[model samples]
Target: MVLPGKGYRFHATGLTHDERGYPDMNVKTQDLLVRRLVDKIRLNADKIILVDERWMEDAKVVVISYGITSRVAVHAVELAREKGIQVGSLRLISLWPFPEKRISQLAGKVKSFLVPEINYGQICLEVERCAGGKCATISLPHMGGDVHTPEDILAKIMEAVK
Candidate 1:
């Protein structure tokens, strides 16, 4: 399970605080803890990463989204397919220790990717990283609230295909 973060929420909350919200962890301890947690996830990535993809072998573009945004991504993918665009979909079932290899393999098939998400380009960064300049990657980020409209994603797909 993943808990989406926010600028305000992360700022307002912290585990380092005591009952009265005072510092309970020193800078060194906090840094070490966070570093180790991140290292653990990356070290055991194969056991953690999960992705569910619906892609066409000849697809020129893929629309990838996660969480609620994935719902709209499917709609947009269908709309693009209806328009004769070889579009496909990929849903990020797991957020951390991202499915980098899966995305990289897809980059060999698809010409580009359009990733829409509620947050500001979080997963899109991973896509770009794994893509390794093999193909284009686009981000249709929303600050928060609602998901992307089919038209919005379709428009981006159209742009990517072109």
Candidate 2:
């Protein structure tokens, strides 16, 4: 069940549907929406929100990144590791619900979070919102024409770990 998303680097061709206004939410539509919400949460949440969490145990900082920007984040992570930084990275395979619980838990244990995104901190807003000042939080945001260099992200990781 691969969902359509903006993975522009991979050259995905799926359209992102845009709908607004729930004024027509009558009984049938409302029930269907409710059932879908429950089924996604109660039945298949773990399955839906794919995460790579191997580095959680010892990481001092966690990088939350996904989509096209995730590949760049990997380079940053490797560089940080080379410099002997206990930096971890989490690629958000699902964007919704924002991984609040995991972020909060990591905040309790780690020093901070680094979120690098192609846009001007759109997703970072959600991260800071969920972080709730638990630990240090920062975002490496760009205007979306070019990706962040590993050096750029490394600098932020270095700053955050400090």
Candidate 3:
């Protein structure tokens, strides 16, 4: 779900209906909104450390995931850590504001960032922007309703680092 700005509560279950009523035929505006939120969260999240995007150079790799997809990503991170891969994950509790600066910092330190999502491909763009060509970015996208497994995320992370 490509949402504009954070702190706004909008629900999106599937693609058939753009339930949030995104601005019509205005892709640029939509992209701008997404960026704005990303910045906002990055700046404001120091309190909870939820939206915080600080870099951990020793982490080696970072994984970005949300919703159900994120659940799997969380498991994957755990698995990777157990295997001594030195992985960490940022699970977006807030969707709109993507925490760009924090992500940018993370991008600089981590060797790679993996974005696992259910859509064809969207958030990958923002991940790239924040990465600023410093770190490689990879996407593990799933179109069907079948939930991705921890193994799925692990595979993508492995592929990204390799």
Q: Highest lDDT: which candidate?
A: 1
Candidate 2 stretches greater than 4 Å from native: 1-43
Candidate 2: TM-score?
0.74
The true-structure Cα RMSD of candidate 3 reads 10.4
Show model 1 residue runs off by greater than 4 Å. 1-40
Task: Please rank every candidate by TM-score, starting with the best.
Answer: 2, 1, 3
lDDT of 2 at 21: 24
TM-score of each: 0.72, 0.74, 0.66
> Which model is ahead, 2 or 3, in terms of TM-score?
2
Candidate 3 deviant stretches above 4 angstroms: 1-49, 52-57
What lDDT score goes with residue 68 in model 2?
86
Worst 10 residues of 2 by lDDT: 12-21
| lDDT of candidate 1 over 11-76, digit per residue (tens) | 223576433434668786677667876899989998998877775667888888889988889988
* Sequence-dependent TM-score of model 3: 0.66
lDDT of each: 0.82, 0.77, 0.74
TM-score of 1: 0.72
Tens-digit lDDT track of model 2 for 59-157: 999998988888889888988888888999988988864577787778788878899998878888787877788877788888877788888899999
